[model samples]
Target: MSLPPKTALITVGATAPFPALISASLAPAFLSTLSSLGYTHLLIQHGLTPTNFGGTPSGQSLLSSLTNLSTTSPLKITAFDFTPNLSSEIATSDLIISHAGSGSILEALRHVKRLVVVPNEDLMDNHQKELAGELEAQGYLIEGRVDNLPEAIKKAERATFKHFPRSGSEVFGRIVEEELGFEAEG
Candidate 1:
């Protein structure tokens, strides 16, 4: 049986059926490479609009910016938007490729999915790059920064899939239980 296409979460770019429009954060070369690599599902988080799509961020992609990226890649791609149900699309993701926004990165890792983090420098998303770099150091994500996407994808493909600890949730429950002083089941 054929396996599902490897997913790469992209949390940047503008999709309006405008091919000439270079992706704001979509990185054409990166997208092209993934396509060549035979990955089918490119999981994308809608990003904020550039003040200028070609060269700037204009508006919030979604009301919360976190819910969606200013990009329309998800809408126009015809790949992920297969159904009207957004939750199903996100829930079935196997891989994730996206910007280094803190929340965005956290969500990908929380699910323990392999990640390809692409940070945008043009918009001064330096913090995102720093976060990606740190995660790479910890072996949490594959790096696809402006300069080194090709090799990063290769490495991600071969990365040792280790489960990131869900440390907080487990710890939090313990604290709550202790505070509430629940009795043990007899």
Candidate 2:
């Protein structure tokens, strides 16, 4: 019996929509590499980035460009602007390539998926580079600039990644409360 093909999920956070960047600038080289590496399915979630693609016809045009790209790649590609159930999408993927947004990174780690983070470098005070750098140092994921995505993905596939530790939200919340000087009501 034959095993099912491998799948990859890619996301560019909604805070800075760059569907066009991924579709036009990044996908061709990256997708071609994945296809050569035996990935059969590719899914991309392009979020709403106000500066680049939000509230304009350019966003639709970018989406159109992605759909057009899907037809030509060797891998079966599905690209979209957003999804309400991101966890479900993460659960279904074998590999994840995403923006270095903390939310997306945590979700992918929680699922223990092999991950490659491509930090969007255009936003002001973007903390993604720092976060991705820290995670990569710990053997958790691979990080790269968009210009070098194909090579990054290749490195991630061969590298060893340790399991991510479960987070303590209650402790985190308490820290936030303390920082805000919230007094407990007796």
TM-scores for the candidates: 0.57, 0.78
Under the 3 Å rule for N, CA and C atoms, how many clashes does model 1 have? 18
- Can you write out model 1's per-residue Cα lDDT over 82-111, one digit (the tens) per residue? 234433444566666666555556666677
Report how far residue 61 has shifted in candidate 2, in Å: 3.6
The per-candidate count of clashes, in order, stands at 18, 2
Q: Give the TM-score of candidate 1.
A: 0.57
Compose the digit string of candidate 2's lDDT tens values, residues 1-186. 855889888888667765434643334677788887888888767666433453222344555655666677778877667898988999999888888777788789889998998777776656667667767877888997777878887898898898876762443344334444587557
Highest lDDT model number: 2
Choose the strongest candidate by TM-score. Answer: 2
- Taking every candidate in turn, the Cα RMSD to the unseen true structure, in Å, is 10.2, 5.4
- In terms of lDDT, the poorest run of 10 residues in model 1 is 13-22
The lDDT for every candidate, in the order shown, is 0.52, 0.72
